[model samples]
Target: MITLISSDKRKFHVLEEVANQSLTIRDVIEDRRGRRRADRIILVTNINSKIPEKVIVYWLRHFLMPEEIAHASMSHKKAEKLKKWEAKFFDTDIDTLNDLILAADSLDIPSLFDGACEKVSDILKNRSAEEVGEISKIENEFTHEEEEEEIPSENAWVWRNEFA
Candidate 1:
């Protein structure tokens, strides 16, 4: 087993095989294969305790069905089930999703990264500009004049509505 220490000093003991889903952890384990047991402790300094817990949950879920997923031989029903499961798993607030994205990227877990990114995109899609900004907690810094006049004038083609 390898111990993953979160930034908040929480320790998660994970089987090497389950943790191997993370390329970074796999590489670290590979590099310290013959070392003492102390080497098995990996400090994930960039991610807090909550994220690691979520990541571990994600890893465990994927680990349970890696072969079925990788082989492309899973039954249609199973695929649909897994898709539904993923949708529910990723249905979280934007801040948590963003944190998951960063943790996944840092851990080199592409599947998790992709899933979290897709969730974030889904939350933003087809929304008005103000809605998107509000959901994402991004302040619109442009003043009234800049928004109504300067920006539209600068990007005239975008505001033309000719296609519509």
Candidate 2:
């Protein structure tokens, strides 16, 4: 088993094949898995727990058996289940979603990047400006005078249950 050290110092045990799904891991494993004392320890020192957990779990599934997702001849029920699982995995809050996107890009996981980006976009779509700001936790930069001058009086209470 390969030892993976996530950015947050969390250690994980995974088969080399699974860990190899990460480009960074794959490069290290390719150089070491065949060596007499090939280092099995991979240190990822710029991420957090949630990202590594997500990566480790996804690679474990996709690396050794990508054919499952690529197989077009599978029974409909099995494919449907996989689809449902993927949908659920992609459904994340804005904070986790943003972190996952950054992690995916750093680790060179294209599918994960696109999947999370799509979800983030979905969350942003059809949202009011204030809702977007609130969802993303973005503080308004307007000063007191600026806020007073630019406040939309007509939609001042747009913060109500209009979207509820």
lDDT of 1 by residue, 1-164 (tens): 99989888999999999999999999999998989988898888967898889999989988988954646788888878878989999998998999999888988999899999998988999999989988998998999999999987899986576674
lDDT of 2 by residue, 61-93 (tens): 566447545486767887777667768887777
lDDT of 1: 0.89
TM-score of each candidate structure, all chains considered together: 0.88, 0.72
Model 1 regions lying over 4 Å from their true place: 67-71, 143-145, 154-164
Top TM-score: which candidate number? 1
RMSD (CA, Å), each prediction: 2.2, 5.8
Candidate 2: regions farther than 4 A off: 36-38, 63-72, 139-164
Count of steric clashes across candidates, in order: 0, 0
Per-model C-alpha lDDT, please?
A: 0.89, 0.75
